[model samples]
Target: ATLPGEQLFEQFTKGLELVFGDKPSLGFICGIKEAVREDGATLPGLCCIDAPYQLDEDYWGSEYQCEVDDGLGSLIPNPCERISPYFGKISEESCKVYGGTYCPLTDCTRLQECVAELIDIARNENRTAFANYLLNAPNITDPENSFQCGWAREYFGFPANFINDNQICEDIKQFRNSRDFEFLEEFFNQGSSSDEPGDDDDNFNVVPPLVLVPPDPENRDATEAVSKKAEVQNGQAWRATNFALESAAKTLNSIYDAIKDSKCPCGGPFCVAGDICKLVQNIAQKITVVGLILIETSAEISKFTYGEVAELGNVEPIQTGERVKAIYDNMVLTGNYLQRRFQGVNDYLERMENRLVRALAPPSAPGPAPETVASPSNPNITFVVRNGVGCDGLDQDGDSVEDNCEEDRFPPSLRLTSKASTSFVCEVDYCLEERFRTQTEAITFLNAVFDVVDDCSAPEFVQKVIEQIPGTVCEKTRFEIIPVQTFPENSTCADVTLPGISAIVELGLDTSAPTVLCGFQVDRSDDDRRVSPDSKTLVIPSERKSSFVDTLLFQTTADNCPGPLRRMVTVQSNEFVYGTNSVVLINQENTEDGSVVPRLFVNPQSCADGSQDDATICDPDPVSDFRFYEVKISVTDAVGNEAVDTCRVIVEPSRRRNLAKQTKDSQRSSSESGKGSKKIIPIEELLLKVAESNVRYTLATVTSEVSPSPVA
Candidate 1:
């Protein structure tokens, strides 16, 4: 930045002096030079010393014209049309790092200052004085001897990377590279160049200052406290373990003293074996004591200060810490030793017990098994399993193992079978049974229908009937209408767990970006166990089997399910109900990428039974005895606020065949002669009461004056 009347001519000349090392070098920039007289027309100075100095030399203007008159036009003509040839004649000592000096060393910084000062001088003060000197400037004796320079373009922040290999750009790069100036370090450390394509004017990308927090005062002793507590636990655990081992050893010795003298059946030579056999029973009892000790010791350790920690309170902290570590190492060894010893003693006892039990037990008898003919009508066609009845210690039923330790031949499994009457393979069982009411005198027998859904994720609508008895009902039931919920309860932001239904929002796919799929957590009461959000086992049955959007895989987020509980469950995002009136389970899992991905428990398995290799998810030929499912549940809160509710779910006829609707249709049809529910209506029952009163009056009249009292 130049200013008015700042002596710009001498300043830029001084920059040339430093670059060329005090030598009288030719001007590197055409635009700035002291003017002088021409060769043929000299005044006082050799070229143009008496003329005013100029800061800007327009190649097309009088300054260049004067240069031509002075016979310097051949060397410095029209710099815009062709850069000054002096650009290719940079001094060997100039700063040369690359093709251009966009941000050169401090030497170039000072030169730029000089050039900038003259720019202002040309505009505000002594403009003509500078202009006169610029024209008719003396030509250099050797154009190749001009000082190399680039400060003007770099200081002005013009792009130095011209995208071409021009001579001026090449000269600037070489001049800057030739220097090893430490003063240029600041420019190199800058994050970006001013001429970069996307650099912002404000340079907002500069590094921010760091912040640090002072350590907490309490934290100074926190590590020592934790270490001390762990030491106390170790000491307590060691002492308890030792006591258990000592007690076991004492009991074994006492038993050995008693058993060695009495057992003498093999006194000839193998009597020692008899004595060892006698010790087997006592050893088994001692092993049980060791197992009990392990459980009790672990339970004691969890009792806070009352347990092992209390026992270690009097010990010195340093000594206790070292002893704790030593005891911990020894505990592992002791545990392994006792376990191996127990196994040996238990094995010997088992062999002796097996021999004695087998000798006393009678010959084994096999029980009769019910025969099955593989009839589809038989609900119990599947095999039944029961534990075998054999001598307690010996192997039975030809398997090479003790009966008590026999391995079950079969695992618990399910098989889908078909019914005989309907050749269609049964995927689900639906049964209804009728019963006449006997206990209730006021109510008549009616078929009560109960429609129910088992899964809560996507509920199937069911219609149920209650007897409507004139008494206090014992049960209350409520099914949540909305399972996938996302709503705040108050002015403050709340966890996404609203009881009301969730508002539906439009969903779109962003295939341009990939994301993890996840869903929201269900609102369960605090006591209710939460199924892992990661391995979401819930299902929302849908009518169509389509993509994620179509499959209804959207829910609000929940915080309880974090870490491993929050997982990325990926599978088919389609819901395949396929239009059968059966259960629908759309297993959608919450994934990490904030997307809902559907997971399948059974894939390539059709809901339709008997489809080839189809693993059906329903019971075949299941006998569900339809009775009124009545249960009473009492809910008592912490404050003893109690509520008792009894719910009775029974099957009811469809709405079209409802009792009230049937009665209405019957009454309407009666005007044209027709039928309906024979159950007594209020109006008909009243009319029948009046008719019976009249009949009683007539009978009284036939019996003479005995009918005098009006049948009220």
Candidate 2:
């Protein structure tokens, strides 16, 4: 008549009893339920038991057919197999209702592998924090070799024993005498009861309490009696403190495990954002709970015999006050370690949040606009200079007011262009005169001022503009713009000499960046061509007696009249080498003379065997029909102004002219003439010129002779 769910719960309880032969504490039962919930398992609910039940796989093989390889050669029960029996009858539909699904065992294996990797990463991070902070070790310059930073055995690799081993920032002698460490060591110790101090009559029992192991039915009552007597002798307050310490130790272990489990186990280049968010939430919640438990336990421990209330007690504390202080300090240090871990999680979450915001931000909502705005009437106009008063001459519009007279309603527009060859000049005087003599004059004045300053409305220029006119305000000035003759580079005009009051003004300074000139020698043939007159494009034949040499000329010009220049060239292909002996050197000499134009010598092949050097040999035939190399040239002037230009060098495949035969024939002819054979010197030696030399040399001709008859 009982319900099926109730039957399952009854069976589960009976199984526990059969193993331990006694009713377990309510906390122990609840602990199991909590573990099941944390593991994310669900099953048919009974009021007493919400956790799912696993079928006896050994007895019921057909119902739980699914098995996974344990990474070893052995197969083990998979989650699907383990959860199948909770449904009473296994079915894909029923299993999926509780979030279970049948999948290849390999999928489960991969998940486990990923989890193992995350656990390893978590352990490494924890080791680093422990080494750097808790141990008070030197800063880790290299994280990969930081193991030596802490106690050698405490953070030793694998099967972590950090919490189990001795670890405190201070000296071991001091730590051993500390009260906080006494409780910690005793709580986590795995040794049997014999290792503890003797428990005889008249002796106070300070040993940490252990869960009672179920004895034989005949001895059960007696075992409980002894445990009860011991608790009474110790005093209930002392017993409560010990229990709290025990709970605290367990909680610490849980925290360590939680850190390992909280990491997302996706083993791909990127994980799902939702999964990462879930991982962040899970870790934060776990840490929060663990922190609360430690705080509560420490509070409980502080209220003990040797704690704050020790003076109020009738009996003196069994332990010393130093022990309490030690416990408190150790708790603080534990919190420090936990805080380090929390900070890592916090940083990772912040980075993820920033990335999410950037990726999800709306594209239509652009950032704020810049300060400057172009005139509505003419986009080219950079500024509009307005005068409070305007108007000049007799009326041409046939109105009561003179045509070019009376206050003008609007300001004149200023346009800057790159067309002018001379500096612009502007005149500023009060009145119904004119803002500009002509529109072209306004444009030229704008060009000059703009070249000197980026913004006319800037703070530095505002005062300068006000002082330019004699007793004339910026708003009242007329003939605002005029043309001025160009001065030498770096020169500025001073002191306004207009027929007016004294006004000091400075104008016309060159600050613009220099320009670089790049050119290449042109070649014309079936294998080479100059499609355009510009130096930007050129074709050259690869076939040559020794190596092909191409001259790349460079020049740099700055506004401050040409000065000493530094030139650098970079070829964007493996087919070319530059400078002396394949080493590019920057010019070090200081000279303004134009005769020494900075030149870059490029040799496609510098050896007779068509090699760039002794180490690299090029194929007698080109690798491809045509290869294009981009040559980038940069130049810097004495004033630090820099410019860069690029040109394309196209290389045609070699034509195989049989130069060896020609050389042999030439050598024979020279010998027959009784001139003797000329030694075949490498052409690269002739082409490789000293970089500092003033003179230049070119290989215009190459001749060799071949003998027709043997020289007996």
Quote the lDDT for 676 in model 1: 43
- Provide TM-scores for the models: 0.12, 0.20
Worst 10 residues of 2 by lDDT: 157-166
The deviation in Å at residue 406 for candidate 2 is 26
Model 2 lDDT tens row, 1-712: 1011122222233222111101111212232233222221222111111123334434343333445577799867554322322321112333443344432211122222332443354245332222112232223333223242222212221111111111111122232333323333333232224444753211123342222122335755554555444432223434444444444444444433443343222211122222323433343344435444544555455444223222322222243333443443333323322333334434444433333333222333343321121212212211111121122111112222321222222222233334433323544221221233233443345445432211111222212122233343222332233322121232222222112122322232223344665666555333234423665655444444345444544433433333344655565542333333432223323345323343344444423334334555432213333334555666554334456787655443343223333444568888788664534323232122211223222211111111111112
Candidate RMSDs in Å, in order, are 46.5, 33.8
Off by over 4 Å in 1: 1-231, 234-243, 265-328, 331-712
lDDT scores in order:
0.25, 0.33
lDDT agreement of model 1 with the native: 0.25
**For residues 124-214, could you state the per-residue lDDT of candidate 1 as single tens digits?**
4323322222221222232222222222322221112111112222332222222111111111122333556554322222232111122
